[model samples]
Target: MNTSAFFEKRVGWTKYTMLLVLLVISFILDLIISIPTLTTTPKLGGIRGTSSVQVPSSDRIGMERVEIGIGIGASEGCMWYGKDDRQCRYTLSFQPSSEFLHLPPKQNVTKHFPDGQIMATCHINTALQAMVTTSFIFGPFFAGLLPFTMILLPITVFMSIFSAISLLIASGQVAYHLKYSIPSFELQWGINSILPFVVVFLQLVLSIYIGTLRCMMRKKNPPPPDMTDEVRLEERPRDNTLG
Candidate 1:
């Protein structure tokens, strides 16, 4: 049987095409998630008479706002509460604090704070940065392997497991930080932060399915008989006829 015809019948175009499409989507999603601007919120302080400050988006991976300060004081506008008193005007700002930027190909990070005090500490930022890096590296590579299904199967399985583990670790860290961190400020997770896990999982499943299909095709369609064997058989029949 012709190799092309066998592949067309067994593997089909749609299966691999869909796999390629999924891979591309996963790659793009990983890149988007890697950007630090995905989440932003106002950091506020104080129970009564609070002030709010907009935290800047992180420039590099693993960078986050861990501490904020708000000041409440009297302004020129007076509504009159009593004989000698003033209304409050809230002023908001972020205090200098330490941040870890876990860029790729680097392990050690430097810490700095103007006041020599650590306001908050959270390792979730580091874990998330690592997860984003992994996805960024593997997503494109997996997509590239789609044309070579035989090679892709084992690698995809490994990647799937790695990605799942990374997701769990990152998620756990985030949960821990949220639960234990400052009560006045809350960190909100954006869609970009969560999309990569879902995409990686889908890639893993598709890789397995495609790999299985390839294996079945190979089993069902054995290689064509050797030309040399057919020639020898024909020659032997002629020899017997002559003898």
Candidate 2:
């Protein structure tokens, strides 16, 4: 007797599951770092100490717009309340970190402006995140499903690069502070230091998984396509005699 077989194919979970987990981790890390803005001012109260910068408005509801400038010999830090382009009282008169002692050539600071030191940080960060995620999220899906890449490649690359930079900016922000040298210390502790390593590790894991999967996919032979036991039996030839 002879037999033949048939095999079925389906996309598996490893590729998508790993990416989903990574996405969750990345968002968690981002939130951990970003939430600082809401807490640090009150927490440290260094330059912005217990004070806030608000944009004074004629509107009955006056928004909290207070700008605090900190320095010893030169301006070391500044904080502004929620509004942009509006004026407010200084948050603090005291300088908190040793960096104030080393004063830069001309300490000029701005709390607003899309790219102004602070605002730029948020902008750069948003832009960068938009970039990295585009790639991280779509790269494998498109490559695996469509690979007609001229369409997705540029966009993915763009997002990947931007997100990479946003990640960098976040890292940079981690090492800075409205409290001056506090960032220097944070660079050693908390989620800041751990974040970079986590990103790198996840990226590597994603890369290796993608690489291995791609190689496995391209191997061509693919065990001659899964022959099923039922099919094998169906294809078997039978000889009849009364046996």
Q: Largest TM-score belongs to which candidate?
A: 1
Lowest summed lDDT window (length 10), candidate 2: 1-10
Q: Whole-model Cα lDDT per candidate?
A: 0.38, 0.37
**How do the predictions measure up, each by TM-score?**
0.42, 0.37
Model 2 TM-score is: 0.37
lDDT of each residue in 1-243, candidate 1, tens digit only: 345545557766666467656655655654443322211211111111111223344575553443322211110111112223223222111221112111123211111111211111112222333343344334323433224544644454455445545544543443343234333224343353355457567666666776677567657743454654565566674444655
Error of 1 at 231 (Å): 14
Cα lDDT tens digits, model 2, 142-195, are: 333323322333443344344445545433442354324322221222334245
Residue pairs whose backbone atoms clash in candidate 1? none
Candidate 2 regions with alpha-carbon error over 4 angstroms: 1-16, 27-197, 221-243
Give candidate 2's error at residue 18 in angstroms.
Answer: 3.9
Query: Cα miss at 152, model 2 (Å)?
Result: 7.0
